[model samples]
Target chain A: MVAPDYLQVLVLAAVAIALIIVTIEVVARIVRPHAPNPNKYETYECGERTIGSTGVKIGVQYYLYALVFIIFDVEAVMLFPWAVSFKEFDGVLGLGTIIFAEVFMFVGILLIGLVYAWKRGVLEWQEM
Target chain B: MVDLMNWAGIYDTIEGFLSGLGLSFIIPLTLYAIAALILFGFVAALVLVTTYLERKILSDIQVRLGPMETGGRRFHGILQPVADGIKLLQKEDIMPKNRDKLPYYLAPLVVFVPVFVIMGLIPLGFIPLDIASLNKNLLVAADLDIGILAILALAVIPTLGAVMAGWSSRNKFTTLAMLRSVAQGISYEIPFVLAALAVVLAAGSMNLSEIVKAQSGLWFIFLMPIGFIVFFMAALAEIHRIPFDVDEAENELVSGVIVEYSGMRFAFFYLAAYAELFIAAALITILFLGGWAGPVLPGVMWFFIKCFVIIYVIIWMRGTLPRVRIDQMLAVGWKVMLPLALLNLLITSSILML
Candidate 1:
């Protein structure tokens, strides 16, 4: 019963996806027009001749948003197992109140972080 | 009243038939191979049809006719996607000079494979089909115990491809798009997972088919309307549709991460996007709309109908709403959707306890 059926399905589907992608690409290579001039191969930037470097300084706002997201994302992941396992304590007296209070306390701490971010205006897109 | 597609029974029969033909050793391999092909074909065909439908629906919503020239005036250019696909296949495959070749090439496949794989796990509900004399129809390819988690895990992977595409393109526009995608992916995923966790909590199982079964009496939408709404909004973000399409703002980014890709490589990204659209709707259907649950139609038909209805809603959103800024997108994901999902979960837990 513990067989890796899901893994097998995944592998099989991966192979199929690969096969389809390859077949389409290879056929396109054979039959499609192949005309690659220097201009055609140039990175598309509104058809203007390339200028400036690709790696430029990005706004710190994006980074800040990502930081807040990562924090919340981790918290969400932890919450899932706890939520699922709530059934294990289904019959215990005061299970509902105990679990609710504990989970909310965990959420409340994260909410504090969120509130800090909000107050700092890091949640604003144009903050940078 | 319970009609099922009976894919499991059909697989057993096929295995038996293969054994009778004295090819028992290859049965497992053959069965999986066929299933894979079926799933691939299903996704490809559905994507093609939906692309056309989106065009036509959008045109109709805007009071115009769409694609009346393709497919010889019959079916309103239903074959336009096929024609467009052939045209794309025949177009020049351009590789931007001075770009990172390996990641550039691998990005589309990375984005596409997982999305394609997800289709096999979506249960279309049981239909009472008399095709192979099989009962107990399980419409999905595999009903893994961790179906919801498997989907959540795989859906998280496509952002890697977008980032790869952006970085490999060696362009500032793609880089900006990649940044937006990463932020969008991270921010939206939390709410998406939380909303889904609410459903999982209510259903008491992560298996999607079981979730559907739990909904037979009352769909989760009725019980957890806020979660359903959050799920829908986060889903739109996951697929990078309008209002959440900051990653690929056409007016600003040209084409975003796929800006440098051409030909079939470009088509892979296009295909994956449509596949994501379908899967998002299918997930909603299964989780909230009660997969294939309706009064009159067959389960499979009901499933697709519900999916298309959601698809229509999404298309309507694309047609109507202006794109939100990146920060605004994150704000909604973090500030609005996430907390609502948590509250919905807490409410659901309290209700279940009572």
Candidate 2:
């Protein structure tokens, strides 16, 4: 559970970050010189006329990798609460095997997903 | 003895001071606002120092004098970062003609805001003050029960900025960089949190302060060395620093997601990187190096000393190590680091069980 005061702290910190960025920008706007050339704002290409829009379709591999990652990522979060409370339950219930086995099962299944990712070469960084 | 380490006692001191002159009409929120501003200044100062240090350190490595002209050659360019800040501010806030302007503008803010939130959750060691006759007051902004998780949840928000900056730029490099960075961040996060979870298991609580307190006997680094390494590496990756900085591969991506930004917008991303580096160092100090736990010196000084050592190591890595390829980073994170983290957890739980 989060302390309510933390919310106030969070708000204050967020506002401060915004203020600092803005303050710096405002200060720079006052003191710095700015000159814009027609070519200066052009998207940089290595000394060649920019060709083709950047909106071209990218490989599906990035999305697929992200999808696999999210599944495993959520599983990691789920393990945290259990990890923190494991000692308490072990002390109270004295059923160490039950809790241990259950978590092992969960993690073991996840590890299999990881292995599958490896075996299928999903984790590999290859050009599509 | 009363606990000066709590936030409530500190608040009472502020309230008493506010009411002392019969100006008690100020709301409690205003006090928090003041604390928040102080923390902001602290983070800003850290970013400034770290940036200068990185430059100087890198220069030293390459046998060059970094920032010798700024703030006078006598001071060896100590004021160079300030000058650079001013220079960055004065530069044009460039927007590409084909850009999605809103996300383009918002990305930096999104990236920048989370640094402060993460800082607030970290305990930098307690300091005593006369107002409440405080004994053991925590230096952190909030001692939330979900302490580290709260930071983790907030920490995840910055990646959205990377994604936004990447997609909105409409540049092939920025978009590609964004995808790689986001993927790297996401993949690395599992190991990062799991390594942290190993600490949680050992400490038996998720509160950052409690974890620090638990380390009073023996530092977790001595107890869980593997967790330390995994966390350190994952954190390095999470911040997109050197070795793990493939997402912003300068040669391949030309500054990657931030390629299109200029002026203050670029500065925001740059500042965020430094701020995260500090937070990562602070987190490591708290979890492994016995935060504020030492002989003779005050907790705050010990905390800073320990944190700086870690920061120095991080900087050394930046200066020395070559950047890993994007695929190699993901592979190590998921394949090597993740498994090691889980094994550490297993080993930790078993030790605690006995």
Candidate 3:
């Protein structure tokens, strides 16, 4: 299937920008009050005033979870569209089986990180 | 209907076919640039309309008029997003005190741009790719072997914005919110990937159109509901919609990572935030709900409808649910959703093998 022409995309984009800009303008006028306060801006937590800035120290372990996640989350995203075409070029291109093995092993290699996180007790709920 | 998708690789064919008609050097580059701009603009329009639809539906679900008063006519809230755009334009683009200026301004565009880039890869209903007089059966865009990688590449940029926005705010609550976004982004992204990988394994291809085509007779949901559910839920969290919008919990971390932004920058953050909601919904429609597949309607119409329904559900969720605690959010990902997604994938693979 051939794609749409550039002019069409421009028309579509113009519609998008116009729609977005207009909508935001209206919503702002509708929702945002004419005046606000310092108290309103101060971090609202529960009914009471905030204690200790809500920015207390965090553990290094959380960082570990994130590190492992960054490596895999992005990788998983790369895997989806490939999965979409798995069987199409099955014989001629060998796109299907190759993608599976590559990603399976990718996940396999990354599972080690999960195990490490487990060993480090990132998955555990108990407090030390 | 004029199709922007024709811009995908159409220029190459155009130049090829039209070379007989005229001489051209700068034509291809100009055409590509124009196409990209259209693509961005189209996605921006989609995000805005989706945002309006989200609010409207959510308001209806809760028994309220969403933006009816905006146009000052009943049901004319249709133009609410348009109006909002004009407001953002006129509003001051305020920079926070003690904030890094470069990435600070760039963050919203960084967050917003990639959503459209991903949109490109999804075959938006097979438009005929009328090349240099050869009729070939294929999609409208570049069918790269690594199409999915482009999506991932784009997906990675938004989190950078989230973290950057938090850090640049230089406020304590903003910092905590930023850290929470890191945790949220990381946690949800895992199950999402795992479940998506499961789908890839089952479908055996990485191309989204191929995935949709494979499900022609039977959508993957019947064979892989658990994976579908997990993927949908994790995607929700990844996009930070309700039930998983802990990153922006008002009762806890203020507006989370984006507490400091105001005026258009704030609007940018807000739009970027809702952009995720719209993106996740579209993804679900494309991936699981069967991209543009239905009996009566045109493919694009079906795709758009399915996408809208998912968007409706996400907005409905926002109105109904209470924010989960950060710890509980993590636990659900690891304990509940992750395990279920993992088991679903394993069972799916085993069944396929059998």
Q: Write the per-residue lDDT of candidate 2 for residues B181-295, one digit (tens) a residue.
A: 8888888888888889889888878999899988888899989899999999999989998998888988998987999888878888888888999989999998899888888
What docking tier does model 3 reach? incorrect
Worst 10 residues of 3 chain A by lDDT: A1-10
Residue A122, candidate 3: alpha-carbon lDDT: 80
Per-residue lDDT for B341 in model 3?
Answer: 72
Q: Write the per-residue lDDT of candidate 2 for residues A60-113, one digit (tens) a residue.
A: 767767888788778878988887788788888786667877988999998998
Cα lDDT tens digits for candidate 3, B51-149? 787777777878887788776676657788888777665554344445667766666656655654555555666543445533423434334444444
DockQ of each: 0.59, 0.58, 0.20
User: Per-residue lDDT for B1-354 in model 1, tens only?
Assistant: 111213446667777799899998766666666677777778889989899989998999889998998877866887899998888888877888879989987898889888877887788777556556554467777777888988998999899999999999998789989988998998889889989998888887888888888898999999999999999999999999997998899899987899988778888899999999999999999989898888877888889899999999999998898898776677778778877888898889888887
* Model 2 vs. true fold: TM: 0.91
Cα error, residue A58 of model 1, in Å, equals 2.2
Ranking of candidates on lDDT, top first: 1, 2, 3
Model 3 stretches with alpha carbons more than 4 Å out = A1-57, A67-116, A124-128, B1-23, B128-143
The numbered model that scores best in DockQ is: 1
